[model samples]
Target: MSEAMRKPETNGAPPVISVRGIDMVFLKKAPGVLDGLARRAGLPRPEPVGVHALDGVDLDVMKGEVVGLVGESGCGKSTLGRVIAGILDPTAGTFRFHGREMSEMSPQERYRAKVAVQMIFQDPFASLNPRKRVIDIIGEAPVVHGIVPKAEISDYVDEIMLKCGIDPAFKQRFPHQFSGGQRQRIGIARALAVKPQFLVCDESVAALDVSIQAQVINLFMDLRRDFDLTYLFISHDLGVVEHIADRVVIMYLGRVVETAPTAELYANPRHPYTQALLANMPRISTEKQAFGQIKGEIPSPLNPPSGCHFHPRCPFAFDRCVAERPRLITKAPGIAAACHLLEEAAR
Candidate 1:
């Protein structure tokens, strides 16, 4: 295996989540409005376009490690997270938990895998049901999953609530009753109730204010230590990922472009897309900064460019980049990038 594909140093243990050749393609919905417009114009109905969300993605996240997946809004980071969290099945891929492929697992084993992995969604308020009280929201899963007895559900909810820094006294209150941060805490409590080993945190702190973001980030770190939990921290915020991630993976236009140890990736990005992303990131410097935007708006997923998906936006794109897809080439130990420039440099 290439260094980037190798599982983290875990004393011979297999990766907690290993997905290979993952591809998520969503068919475009033909809205009623579109059909009405077509009829009014006397044109044929439009064919459904396939929105390629993920393209041949491979990733290995080890036990007790934080892997930060950073990309632009529509670059499939969220989709990849959801795939790992078992929310959405990919169009093509092999999902392997530990050493066992998900396809080979029996029903009982599949259920156990589902319980072992959990997802914290981007919108806390939208994720929580308005009709359910806080206690029911957090306690229901555990009771149904047999993690806790129905009679002890309330006390069990209270324990997790305290651990997540949410006040259990407000158990009877609705989701709208708490602040954004508290709602997020409730979401965390719900995920923890199942005693999950891995968490797919999709923009978990993005909605919070700066101060509240810090609190939530710290809470994640504390929880990791306390519970020995592994995390797939998906976010668009480079700064936040730099602070909390051990390794960072950068994706663009439905493809993973670069990955490396957090400090090294930040200090010396190999791919042009990674360089552009880091250059535009807001920095705390007294010196004046010149933020250079990546050229062109991100291409639509409905008709992604041929060859390398990022070729249109990459500053270093050559004729070969326009004609041939680049596989990730190992740049240095623990670092790899998918770029034709690196391949040319090797020759």
Candidate 2:
């Protein structure tokens, strides 16, 4: 085992949530009989392929911590978010919340868990019902779960809206009546209505304009202070992730390549893939030399590269990296990376 695969010492703080060895696979739809027959006549085989969305991913999020999950599109970031939110069952592995296994819970317990961990989806407009009033949308969860009476639902909705920077009067309007930023605020209000301890924010601000994104980001921070909320903030935008995340996990080809403090990871990214990603970030001045850009397209999840999944695109890949899969191991305190270059550097 490489030094990078070794576990780092913990500071005695228990993680609020832990995801161990998660694997998700989606089988491709079967091809038609004609296509199968064509394959017999020198055409490509019609065998069903599997998309490995999350391959043995392990993650730990400490209590009250905001962890950013960043990766390119199709890298399985959103899939991981859904799994953590209990919206999608994993093909393998276990998810635990506060030391309790989530999969083993009863139906009532599962409902409680769902209420405890809420989701803020990317498109606020699509997430909210077009015909439903803001109050109905925001208060639905609390009312359904018996957290508040129907008579009190309006009051609870108003309070949450105010906290999320939306006016109480707007609660009477339909989702179509609100602006994009206002709509997102309504989404936040709805998530907050459940009084969730943890939130899965899957590209929550990606659909909004730059100005709106900042507003929503600030609102999330303020709510964290007021409500003590922990977040699994998934985004493709590194700038947004850096602004909010205490720790950041970089994923590539459905696996975590590196995990570290936001500042440390940005300053000294251990994995070559991470370095390539950071290098592509837009710089303010032309005087600054361009960092190394990542070359080549990402490998398809249906047919991912063998050994280290990133070997095909990694600039520093060696012969060993082509044949030996690297495991996420600690390189520094609270920092873990899965890369052959980091292992060599550590040695």
Candidate 3:
């Protein structure tokens, strides 16, 4: 087993971060009465309804655990990460940090939460300021927040750069001067400078090369162990998630479809969506799949199919799947599935 898979388990500890039935609905702007005219003129047309970016997401991250959030693009994995990091408030449902209700926190408690939860974005170069030098980019936060004295900022930044595997000599250089991997390291260093307890990594390695991806993932594991950090690692790459995640959460069209411990989910996926995803992967093992690929593209969230959101694409979907939504229910130990056909599949 990989070292990442060997990390200590939380074992049902109280959650450091918790979310229940959180809904993040975004109002996609409409183009007004010009819809027909715009279409005729080959211009952009209006949307009829709001985008359901996240619909009734429930998740919990125990302290020191790395929970991987996996799905295709536009599946709300990144939005869910943002919600957990406090970058975006949910439209509905409860969010608690260290057992304290997010909405009910005092001013100081809110500030602490804000600093404790940090986000490392997908595009490292785009996230970094072009004009700022590496030193200011990483050291400014701690200095301004009184975590590090102004006089010690340079040394502090140097220490951080070393920790993140960046050369201190590049402290004076801008983000553009560094390679993609180095820029990502700088981004990681910047997040660490704030002394965050939790990290929401939104496709943090998606832009890197295959070799670089492994290196960055290894670095994340090292840092997680060193800092005792908890993470909501969001990415579309199931291969990466399989390698690093202790627990995996799968989402489809703004809602969670399945969740399970890494080994069990990969060994036997309960949801058809999860099965399709696994089937689509390039399997180099001895096993051969009897089924073909999942058909069609994902339905637009603005008009997601009623009942089970995944029913439209599911092969085994029956009448019940088209009439009523399936709630997330436990199917086995450390496994939960949100599909009407789960029990039927088991039998």
Candidate 4:
């Protein structure tokens, strides 16, 4: 990717997706009949508790840019993607697409915005309707969105399947008949059928074999070139993220800890958490070294550790780290991290 395209500010174009202070909280339990009756009867109800899925997260994806969102499992990577894809609304935040705030959009504008951002899930088979044929699964959306005329849906679906590397002959087959990799391709095709400008690929290839993962990753690059698509690729695979992402965002316990250009981050990680993640990533080396691991378990989001979420595991944790949360400060032209060490070094 060209520098101009990677950084939208150079061209003065708004990011394809701009998120600020995004927070997603899910209720621990659904309300039952008694809870509802209590509310209706004006009786005292127990306090509602929530899982902090995302907390004060911020991000930006320039047009046609692929940003890798990497974190350990249950670290809010998928939750952040779902919010960006419009599948789940954040409890608090400002989400903008092409300079328009989603919250401020009129009904028609919101509908169009929703259609423009699509998500491809990790479980291809589960995401697809088991009984629906490939054609219906991929064709129905474009028809409903008026992207294609109902009469031309078949031809459109065929064209899409072929573009996604699936055979047009299998359009009538149900998802169950296809292999895992093929089912993932069908999911890709269905997302593309809607003519979306952005896609949130939440562990899109994690279920596939290593060989199949390569094919899917290449397909994503091809589609980006062919369709002018921007992506928020969420995954825990550091190797895969390094290969495909132009920039990387690191998350831990529902907070963004570091973000920088991919090469810069890999070559010179700033935050201790980011450094630990990269240190543990498996890489082939002639001089053997034991695979390192970050100390301590990740704190629960429900009751996250005070101040820096990674302080308990961070090797460089200090009094300041335990008492005060560090702000994401700019260390270089394109690098930012939330760590007290950087602040101390500057001081």
Candidate 5:
């Protein structure tokens, strides 16, 4: 298989973007006087807890590769995406762009890095400015960054809009005047205007209809082919991930539990979390795909279970699973999984 089709982890080339030991914690503030009033009025009171959004996540994105990031809601998929796009800085850990530490980069270097890595947000309605015309939204950035002269902005905007399947005629319309799919295309065009080499697509198609989703996905494939862009596609839909990704990264409770070439991971998932997620996804064939029941609710991240975060819900939990967290270790060529029982499973 071509290097682009294989697991990117096995590639000797240094990653275009590398993330190491990323940990993010959100402090849920204590209840204010409103909480006391609510309690007095027999209303439910909010509990304060430090929500751990991500936990020691390590990931790498090779140039010219699409890596799917999948996990349940609140599992930190979006957080990781934002961190990679420089939208949010990790509370702890290191992010490197082209072998240089992101946090240590000079202001000029940082601006260049941020422009090179752009994000496509999920909700088009909220992401696009309702009041501004589409032309301004997409054209202003490139002109401000000196990517194009003001006199040429019109042609440049039209070119980008056309590439993303948006009509150049609609450039004068506001975001609210466009349909959901058109709005999303506008968002894509805006990202493309920045001349980004990497894109962090955080559930970029989840809100669109199934048919629209397919069209957008195909558009992404076409764009990738044309520009050699790298994508970090984050989604909860395994089906979509299966179709769009060359490699898949499975995260749980802010930590990556498994990563492998798309087909291999789906066929032979080592981590129990990955197994359960795959089993839950609807399949067209009736070949009995149930791996095992993933019992128990996902424990609260505020005070997650000791040792492995997934241990409480894992079917094969043992003393070690409850005492020490397992690192994501290589299991085979082009495959890696975080599970203490990998050796036993191999045997």
Candidate 6:
């Protein structure tokens, strides 16, 4: 088999999806001209700052592998996912699927690329249309893309609905008629309608109850096996990622702090940010151990701290961390971390 068709192994095929140096910036609306003029006359700058949603973020997802993206709220996990799905264009970056540049693709080409990459949003209720029936919702993609004839739309929708663990009869029901978990299942069915090769699940299970969360997660696992799907699973819940992710990426303040195999990351986190994140996870153990406590609120993206963005909260931060930004360097085989401390450790 060709490299692109091969499944993920320890050191196997190149990434099916590759994102490099992605930077997404949102321009904040400036204040009135009068305010700006006043600011120019020996006052604070009145010009609106640019919000850096993603700052030079890099990631790779191999075919048929589940990669987890974990971070605090507003840490750019969802923004990255949207970029990968081609729903939101990045301010500056390269996104490639099967070695083809996603940004340069034509409309038809982009549509085809989108067919291969799909997204499952966080809020089930918000994702689905209130007026549309479940059948229509799931079949909309295939119909627009001409994947199936109008006569066969219902049949195709029924097949995927069943595959996603939803009853065929439930297709006629509106989204409001269903519970949170069921609504999520319907959303999954919609994404599956296109028979995507890659899935970007943005907090897919966060809204459901604990028991229901497991069921939804299991459905995702089963669907992956049955459909040969690769996923970019984004979540704030480290526990859920531990259960499903093959590799995990830790994000803080719009940049990746660390990336490692699931077991390796949980076992030994190199970056102080990663260490602090893992240390705070809820656990039952009463044993005394050194735990790094996260301090201070995340700085606003519009005016983020210079040098190391995490320096304000990182206990191990030093003068160099405040003066120079760190690049992600491979600290171990298949594990990379962005921290000045690692350079000393490596030497």
Highest TM-score against the true fold, candidate: 4
CA shift at 43, candidate 6, in angstroms? 21
The true-structure Cα RMSD of candidate 4 reads 2.5
Where is model 1 more than 4 Å wrong at Cα?
1-9, 29-48
What digit string (tens of lDDT, one per residue) describes model 6 on residues 1-347? 24343337536556889999999987776567877677778777645667899999999998888999999977899999999998999999899887778768888887898788999999998999999999899998898888888899988988998898888988889999999999999999999898899999999999999999999998998888889889999999999998888899999879998999999999999899888888888765777766547788878777778899999988998999999999999977779999999997778
Model 5, position 250: C-alpha lDDT score: 94
User: For model 2, how big is the CA root-mean-square deviation?
Assistant: 6.1
Error of 2 at 200 (Å): 0.6
Model 3: per-residue Cα lDDT over 1-347, one tens digit each: 45654664567566899899999888776455688688889987545568889998889888877899999988999889988888887889899888888779998898888899999999987999999999999999998888999999999999989888899999999999999999999999999998999999999999999899888998998898778888889989999999888899999999999999899999999899999999897756788855568998988887899999888788998999999989898987669999877666666
Q: TM-scores of the models, in the given order?
A: 0.92, 0.89, 0.90, 0.93, 0.89, 0.90
Backbone clashes for every candidate come to: 0, 2, 0, 0, 0, 0
| Model 2 error, position 209 (Å) | 1.4
What overall lDDT, based on C-alpha atoms, would model 4 receive against the true structure? Answer: 0.91
The 10-residue segment with the lowest total lDDT in model 1: 1-10
* RMSD to true structure for each model, in Å: 5.3, 6.1, 5.5, 2.5, 5.8, 4.3
**Clash pairs (backbone) in predicted model 5:** none
Per-residue lDDT of candidate 2, residues 87-185 (tens digit): 899989988887778768888887887789989999987999999999889989898889898888888888898999999988889999999999999
Q: For residues 1-347, could you state the per-residue lDDT of candidate 4 as single tens digits?
A: 55554543427788889999999989999888999999999999997788888989989898878899999977999999988988888999999988889868899999999999999999987999999999999999999999999999999999999999999999999999999999999999999999999999999999999999999999998898889888999999999999888899999989899999999999999999888889888887887767767777877788888989899998889898889988999888668999999989998
lDDT of 2: 0.87
lDDT tens readout by residue for model 1, 205-290: 99999999999999998898788899999999999999889899999878999999999999999999899989999989999888
Candidate 2: stretches off by over 4 Å = 1-13, 30-48, 286-292
lDDT of each: 0.91, 0.87, 0.89, 0.91, 0.88, 0.89
Clashes of 2: 2
Scored against the true structure, residue 2 in model 3 reaches a CA lDDT of 58
